[model samples]
Target: MDEQLKEQLVLEATRMLDKAYVPYSKFPVGAALLTKNGQVYGGCNIENASYGLSNCAERTAVFKAVSDGNTSFDYLVVTGNTDHPISPCGACRQVLAEFCDADMPVLLTNRKGNIKETTVAGLLPGAFQSGDMV
Candidate 1:
């Protein structure tokens, strides 16, 4: 993605931080997924008492986009309240690998304005795909 669009996506993810429903860990995370057709969907992490039922911001955004018929994505931006950029968790990486292209760009950002650029393949090398199972 272009620098301007990446900035815009980061801002959208940052804005979503306030919408997170974090009570246990108190760590708010936001994610923005940009579709191949120029659509952006933002999501915030929602914490649950059971913890296992809680969804990550990245998954939430992906789920929302998929639900709206936007499975193909170009870029994804994630933001958190830390000094350094925060990458997605293992589960989020697997979920992303399921829907995103191997070379899809993923941008990680922090409240301190730090940003890191990485790709889905970089995040999850040798990822298992549907074809592998078949």
Candidate 2:
């Protein structure tokens, strides 16, 4: 992705941090997904009373894009409050593999402006996909 776009995505993700609904862990997370067609979608983590029902920011952004009829994605940016960058959870990685190419870029960032870049395959080596079940 271009530097300009990447910066924009990071900014958007960072801005979304304020919108996270974290009444439990109190760790706010935000995600921004850039579509292949140049559209960007942002999402903030939302917590529920039932821990199992809580949704990660990454999945929220991905689902939003998918719901809007978008499947192809260029990259994803996630922001959190740690000093170092924060990566997506296991569930989010699986969901990403379901819709994104293995080589898709996953950018992690922290409130301190630190960034770490990885790919979907890097996060989930030998990830289980639908074809594997066939």
Candidate 3:
């Protein structure tokens, strides 16, 4: 994806993050994915009383595409209001790395306009694939 597209995703992520339901952590996060079809999907963090059940923004966006029968992400934008854009959790990283290719780009941005671009390899180096279990 081009820088322009990446910027758009970042903006969308920032907007979505403002709507996050995070009364406990008070840390709102948003994620936006750019599909191969040039479509964008975004999701905000939804926290639950059970921390284990809390869903991260990354998984929410990815799962939305997957549930709609779409795979292959060209790029993703994740953002928060912190000093740095929040990275996905271990579970979200594993799940995304499973579905993403090595070159899949994940853009992390903050309200300060700082951005960091990381690849699937960078985020989850040598991640375990389902085939490893079989």
Instruction: Judging by lDDT against the true structure, name the best candidate.
Output: 1
Return the TM-score for candidate 3, rounded to 2 decimals.
0.95
**Using Cα atoms with residue i matched to residue i, what is each candidate's TM-score against the true structure?**
0.97, 0.97, 0.95
Candidate 2 per-residue lDDT over residues 1-134, each given as its tens digit? 78998999999999889999999999999999999999999999999999999999999999999999999999999999997999889999899999999999999999998999999999899999999987
Residue by residue across 9-115, what tens digits does model 3's lDDT show?
Answer: 88889888888999999999999988899889998999999988989998889999999989987888899988875778889889888888877988888889888
Name the runs in model 3 displaced over 4 angstroms.
none
Query: What are the per-residue Cα lDDT tens digits for candidate 1 across 18-71?
Result: 999999999999999999999999999999999999999999999999999998
What lDDT does candidate 1 reach at residue 111? Answer: 88
Where is model 2 more than 4 Å wrong at Cα? none
Candidate 1 vs candidate 2, lDDT winner: 1
True-vs-predicted CA distance for residue 78, candidate 2, Å: 0.6
**How are the candidates ranked when ordered by lDDT, highest leading?**
1, 2, 3
Q: By lDDT, is 1 or 3 better?
A: 1
lDDT of 1 at 99: 98
